[model samples]
Target chain A: MRVIFNEEMRAVADDLDTMAQDVRRAINLSCTALLKSDVEAAQSVIDGDSAIDNLESSILDQCVKLLAKQNPVATDLRVVVSTMRLASTFERMGDLARHLAEAARRTYPQSAITPDAMPLFTQMGDFLTVMADRMVSMLADRDAKTAEQIILSDDQLDALHHKTFDLVLADDWTGSRQDLINVVLLARFMERLGDHAVSAARRVVYIVSGFDPTKEPSRDEGTDID
Target chain B: MRVIFNEEMRAVADDLDTMAQDVRRAINLSCTALLKSDVEAAQSVIDGDSAIDNLESSILDQCVKLLAKQNPVATDLRVVVSTMRLASTFERMGDLARHLAEAARRTYPQSAITPDAMPLFTQMGDFLTVMADRMVSMLADRDAKTAEQIILSDDQLDALHHKTFDLVLADDWTGSRQDLINVVLLARFMERLGDHAVSAARRVVYIVSGFDPTKEPSRDEGTDID
Candidate 1:
């Protein structure tokens, strides 16, 4: 029985890894679509989101089964339940990526970010892609150092978000209202992507260290990002 | 054992109910602060948010303890785990309220919404207060009818959101870029508050009927509010 429970735990971890890979793909693809105004790539990212949804559901189903059958306790109980919580954040991360894709799709034939603002977004995509990759690695290894690095990188995303905000509200901003709105929303989406990664990492810290990190870092409240 | 487990489940439900009430209070206070530009009230709302966060953490801790000790199964297991999910949404709802207060406080000495656009926010707050009331009731009663009503009311909030968006981007919209940004974020916070309420209702629906509603309602995907 114990051996079967261990195997099922392993299976849950595998599902989460798959989910993370799909989200990483979505993030990179959606950001590229936004930057390039590629309608087809945007559509592909939008269409692929349902697959992430299905994976989250399957992972959650597995968690329920593990709890009901294996009756895992102590650290094992934390592992099973945190798997559910992690899947929730991963699922939300997918939705955030889709929001970025939708921005691209909605602006089809027109780039969402004006050329003057292009570099900021490119920087965001670059940093976020790195953050997404680290998030997945942390999931597998529970490396506290990796988790700290992810949080630090999120600060960079926030700085970019603020820069874009300042530009849009600047007197020199000659872009149309739609352009301003688009960039602000896009910036917000990127910042939130980082927040979700941090939230996932904080949950990992909780599971590994048995110390609740939820109260320590207000930024770690991914749910509050909405 | 079954009886004790049943008592613990009731307690979880009760904690969720308390959390919902706190969120409802936060919403009303924050909206009042925003409308009145009452920085003191806004500060109170911000200070009170930690209470909701603590409640969420405590509820989640209870869930983990129940899972480890009682070893719930089938519907019983679903009840415990879903309570954790419910707490998450409720905590987020409280955070959304805090965002509203932050909007009010950030713009102190000047209202976030212009007088010309103030009526719309008034209507949103009035309607949302009603919806929040119904959501709390549904959490306790698991009333399907109440859940449907909550979804319907959320549509009203969405319409207001779009109307405000159009006004902001209208060719004649003469408000400062700061006003436009403020209203947009405030509008989003209000819409997301409704979404969180609907999400909580859906989770309740899931708990009561075992019907997965995640796919049925796209709005409940809180990340999709963009």
Candidate 2:
């Protein structure tokens, strides 16, 4: 009985892990579609989102099924429930990536502004790519420290976002304001994607640490600064 | 054993239903604060949101605990999982409403647009308020028909959104373009709130029907009959 129970538990974990992998792939595919200006790839990501959603649903269903069937204890239950939430976050991440891809498709073949704007966007894209990779790694490792790091990384993304706005609104922008607005919206989407990833990373920290920052601490003590 | 089990299940359901009620109130409070320019009410909503988040986490914890201890199956699992997701949507609704409140506070006294422009903004507010109320009712009743009705109602919100843009870009507009732009962004937020509510309604329908519309039915299969 114990052997069978252990095997079933492993199966559920493996299923969730595989779903996470699929989410990572979907994010990469969406980003690649954006960078290469590939409409087909963009459409593929949009169309393929349904599959990712289905997978998320399936993983949650399985986790619930296991909990109902096995009556997993405290830690196990937390892990499963946390994964369920994590899966939803990953699904939203895929949606954000797809939105970016679509935006790229819409504004393709014509540069809205001078080539100077490209470098900042490229940097932002690089930041997102790193964030995505780190998010996946943190989820797999369940490393609370790494998860915390992801949240801090969002500050840098925020800086980039501010810079993006300044560049768009600068006097040198001779492009159509509407097109510039779309670019801002696209950058906003990417920034939000980073925020969601950070939020998810925070959730992972909560799962592993048994303390959610969303929960207020009972008491605050003053910290010493150098 | 059966008696004890049923009693525990009842307790869980009651807690979830109460939490949902609080969610409805929180969202309404935020919206009311926005429309009425009640800064105190808005602050109350903002301060109270932590309670909602806390409630959400504890409700989730309870769901996990119930699954581990009671091992609820079949419909019970669906009920818990559905409620969990619904709670999240409610939380986001509250967040969006809070944002609207902040926007109102930022644009206090509702700008000095002409009386004619005021009518259009009033109409936009009315449309959003009605949509929000309908959504609350749909969730409470779990009525798929009402959910579909609300989805159709979103088209009205979209129309109002366009009307807002038209009014802002009109030749008679003498106000600062930035103020009009701000109003446009606010209008967009209201439209998005409607979209989110409609989405929540759709999820309720899915929970009740166990139907995957994404897989089985074409979204526009019968819409062209008129």
Candidate 3:
């Protein structure tokens, strides 16, 4: 029974890893779609989201079945349960990627990004791509240090996101309202993509440290617009 | 053993009920703070979110303990697990309320919603309050039909949110870029709060109907700028 349970847990991990890979691909495609005005790529990302959602549900079922059949306790339960929590974060990450794609699709032949903001957005996309890679690594390592570093990368993403605002809000800004709106919303979508990474990373931290930040920390993490 | 497990499930339900109530209060206060520029009220909502987060973690602990000890299966397993999913959605709802309050606190002395947009935001808040109330009821009744109505309310919230974009994006929109940013972001936060309610409500529907929308639905739920 112990051996079988271990194998089942491994299967769940593999599922999450696969989901992460899908999200990684989706973000890359979404960003390309955004930058290149590639409608097909954007549409692909949007359509692929449902498959990711299905995987998330299947992962949940695996967790429930393991609990029912194996009756795992203590540490094992923590492992299974934390993974379940991470599954939703993973799904949200996919949703963020899909949104990125939708932005591309909505703008159609024209890129969603304004020329002045393109450099910043490209940076944001690159940062997210790296962060997604790090997420898969962190999941494998479950090393709290790796997870913490991901948070630091998130800070960088936030910095880039903040930089966009000054441009959009400046008196010298000459973009149309629609352009400004696109910039505002896209910057936020990128920031939130980072935030979701942090949440997923934090869950890894929670599992590794065995201290639930939600309970243990009084740290005032101010709410982002994300 | 059966009776004991049932009682344990009841305790978990009661914890969630308390959470829903706390979240309801937070949303109302947050909205008040946003409209009235009530810094103190906004601050209260911000500070109060940790308690809500703590409750969420405790509820998870309770769910884990029951699963580990009772090894619940079949319909029993479904009930416990679905409620656990709803717990995160509940926690997110609280966080959204806190974010709403933070919007007020961040912009204190200056309202987040412009005078022209105040009526719309006020209505959004009222709708969310009603939805939260419905959530608590739906949780008690586990009524799929009530859950569906909650989604209908969310559709209305989406319409109100969509209505804001036109006003903000119109050629005549004269607000500063900063105000526009705030209005755009706030509208999203409110819309997402409604979406979270739908997720929670849908989880109830999933448990009752045995139909997992996460798995079955091909509906293109577009990505939020959130």
**DockQ, all candidates in order:** 0.55, 0.28, 0.58
Q: Backbone clashes in each candidate structure, one number apiece?
A: 0, 0, 0
Instruction: Write one digit per residue (lDDT tens) for candidate 3, span A2-100.
Output: 999999999998998888888888888988899889999999998898888888888988998998899998878888888888888888878878888
Error of model 2, residue A188, in angstroms:
2.0
Q: Model 2 over residues A106-219: C-alpha lDDT tens digits?
A: 656644323556777777778877877787788777888888888777878778777766776667766443555455556666676776777788778877987754564311
Off by over 4 Å in 3: A216-223, B218-225
Report the error of model 3 at residue B16, Å. Answer: 0.4
Model 2 Cα RMSD, 1 decimal: 5.7
Model 2 vs. true fold: TM:
0.81
Where is model 2 more than 4 Å wrong at Cα? A1-15, A18-22, A25-41, A111-117, A169-173, A213-226, B1-41, B109-121, B158-185, B212-226
Tell me the interface RMSD of every candidate, in Å.
2.6, 10.5, 2.5
True contacts kept of 1: 0.46
| Docking category of candidate 3 | medium
User: Local distance difference test, per candidate?
Assistant: 0.83, 0.64, 0.83
lDDT tens readout by residue for model 1, A33-79: 99899888888888988888888888999899999999999988988
lDDT of 1 by residue, B1-226 (tens): 9999989888888988998888888998998998888898889888988888988988998898999999999788878888999898888888888888888887788997898679989999998889889988988887878987886667788888888888888788898877877777788889888887877777778888888766573523334445
Q: TM-score of each model's B chain? A: 0.94, 0.76, 0.94
